[model samples]
Target: MHIHKLPDDVLHGILQHSCYFQYPDFYKWKRLLLLLSICKRWRHLAIPLVYNRVYLSYYDQSEDTSIVDDEPVETIKGAKTKTNLDLFVINNCASLARYADIRILFTSNAFKGLNQTIERMKSVLKTWSGIKTLSLTLVNDVYFVEHQVTAELYDAAQINQLTKELYNLIPGILNLRLKGSRLDRTNKHLYGKLAGYYNNQLKQLSSRHAIGLSDNIYFAQISKLDILLNSENGYKLSQMCTTSLVHLNIRGVPVNYRWASFKTNNDVEQIVFPHLKTFNISYLSSTPSVDRTGTELYNNGRLKIHFPVLTKLHLWSPLGHCELLASAIFPEKMDTFDVLGSSKTMQVLSNMRIPQVKKLYLNVASTTSNIRHATLQLINKILENSPGSKKNKLIIHEDSIQIDPAVIEWSQLTLLHIGAQINMDIALKVIAKLPNVDELTFYNFVAENIPEEAFALKNTSGCHNKLEALNSSITKLMLGHNELGHSKDAVITVIKYLSVRLESLSLFGAQVAFDTDMSEFVNDYSHIYPNLTNVTFRLLTAKVL
Candidate 1:
């Protein structure tokens, strides 16, 4: 039977599954439009899915057109007629007023007549009354525009007017994001107006290089706040007033010792975030030198900031900055700690004590030899200091360290994800050690500097035997990255030796050549794994058979 002849429920499910509204891409939208053009029933089922989230952007159509006559026609006329995103949204999809999310993007050099563009944006916002989330991005040019000055900057007053109109039109908006617009201290009046309107209803706020807050603003129900910190107008932690905030992410903030001093005041003793639970800080500057000899630095010094209920902490900063922040704000009871950076951060994390940490993600930068060595050292220290009661799950990315079987407590590990390029021999040895791992993931399996005999089935006396005798607790295996085609022999050997009763297998980014038949390979391997029932491939490429 044809797809359109199916039941309403089935058709609706198919349309929902195929819609790409969440991912704002031109090709995806074209595909959705094609699907809608199939038939009336398909259009009826797919309309809501396609209009659930709308992204409007200024698309330059000048390159798509060719000049046929010797006399030059004005490009502005074509731009207005063909590249208008606001007109497309209002003319084509304005009937779907219940769109949950709306994103408006303006390229710095694309639009003409700034005031007209703003008016068009205001009209678009007024047309959509049921939007729960709104995102505005004004992309800046790499160099200054010389010819037409209208596209260089967005007027502060115009932006404020647009924001006020949005708030008045969509009072129930729960999430708001503003990005790439230049608003410095001059925009304090805008913030004052927004603070009054969004204080009670907005639940999440994220901004990048836009809307600098010069005065204190209170968010009554705001729980998650993400901001890209700039030197001029970045919000100070002490200036924010919120009682329900639980997740806070601050990025692009220059790291200096003075950040710890932000909390120190002669009048106020301590600034407290009573209910915050998750704090993430990243993209710290590395130009400043830190004093590592001072013993008082580790005790948080005179800085008095308290995260009374903080449990999950993620730090993506330079080694010195991570150490400095951890020493000052390290909570007593952290449930999950994700340390992502170079070996400098790892070296500092190794010595730190967090006995309450149950789930640790070490995303260390291992591009250099020195960083790889430090990562290995950090892993050893983590295993050494791990508590014996709680079973820990570890995720290692970007580097593979040699595992010393004698020092690691293999039984304590529950899930291990190795998303890195590692020697095949080392991977086999590590798997043999982790007798209790239930799930294992390997990314970019590297088999360099290994003899062919190592993977040969005839070699019964080598480490292959240990791999064959490894424990049977593992049930899931995932292979990832683009190097899978080259490492097929090593992957097959590992699968043949591993005695675990596998239940699921996933291959991601596996490159299949025209000569290779993935179905036949799967059929051949299925007999070896009697319990394997679910097998999936993501981003698999091959010539048509």
Candidate 2:
């Protein structure tokens, strides 16, 4: 059936699932282009979704850059007719924007022709249609254009000029997101001035300044707020626009009013955020600082907090232990719900009536046996609580823990990547415990006494039995971690272990078997891994040695 014939939600889901409106290169845009040519109804739906946002990245030369699409052999709205931007789309996927992100990253560099850029930019902006909101997420000093992405920090004056240029060119509303900055730490006015310049259209902001205070009127009606640095005026800023907030991220210890604190004068019906989508919070403490009053209020269910549209809630406490209090209400369906930490996080994960998490990551690092037991308990709990167990991609860091298969249902595990020396005995022992993992990626491997074969092809007697437990299940293997100065024997040894079963192998992290030609290496080892079809790598230079 034609996807457009489905209901709005269903059809939208199909387009999203197929990534029709995605960057098109490394995507299904050609089908979208075909639909645009033939299907009028499809065009009606797709035009809005396709050109909703334009990611024009000119990496090499931000100046003298009349951006051209390396793919999509057609032009749009005569904007592509002009020399500078006769075709207003570029094709490369440095990152992928999800369904809701209608962001067109056009900053610093204007789309000027080989001769005059500013006039060409205005002309393109004038012709381009259906782009109602131009949102930018400026995280760090990086801007993407064409095949290359470069980083060069800008000062106050430069920022002001760029803002003015964009504001002047595009007729639609401009919403800027200051996620991170490349501004010098000493330079104070740049963030404030840039934020304050277009505060009206700002929807999401990550700021450390004392916004919404008497000193500065830096509130741009932002709905998603990230408090990066703990400012003194954080309390007032969070309280300023409680009505329109869709997301709030608190990056420090959630103790005071700076931490999603929606309290009133004893109002039981005061639901803080009626339509918040996500709430990501982290703490730098093992013991989360909750005062006496806060605990008392939460215990009685007096503090009302509601998330009707929440899809994700990622809270990680890497520094120390963490414990989530009896929180408020959440919808039945959540895309990703992660609450990760050292020890306490594991306890919470194991005991709680867990939600249907789409992606679960567990990092348990402890040398003690009790913690290891708790880690295994958490793993078992995760498998039991989560629905559609296969779709749930579970990752746990068991650096020191030994998985005693008899105690737990280790057979339920399908994919395991323990954060430790990949070639070491512990990692193999754990992988050996989970016999169903179909794919594996190992990094930072030690060139110790790696067995010629992890598990004997004919069933051997010692640790060999545990090493290649994934031989039948594992088809794809990615070996990362650059031991650039080390010998290629590490790579050869590990590959030799899985050589019989592996169909594809990829090397990343700047070391390609000490710069040895992988084609020749594969050919030389052709007799071993007869099924190996593809091999890829990134060869590093001798300077890195």
Best by TM-score: 1
Model number with the top lDDT = 1
- Tens digit of lDDT per residue, candidate 1, span 1-545? 97657899998887788884553454465566677778888878777777656544432343322324442222332333222344346547654534333322222343233233445545655555566776644442334323223342435566567557656666666777665445333223343355446766778887765355544455667888886654444324324554677888877655543342233234343455678888887765455344433222234455445677888878776433563445444566678777666666667667766546767666654434666645655666765666642555666665455445454555556677776675556666676677777777766555454545445443433223322334436655555534444555554444443322234333223333212333543454445444333544332444211
RMSD of 2: 10.5
What shift in Å separates residue 74 of candidate 1 from its native position after superposition? 20
Name the lDDT value of residue 487 in candidate 1: 58
Span of 10 residues, lowest total lDDT, candidate 2? 93-102
How high is each candidate's TM-score? 0.62, 0.54
Task: Please give the CA lDDT of all the candidate structures.
Answer: 0.54, 0.47
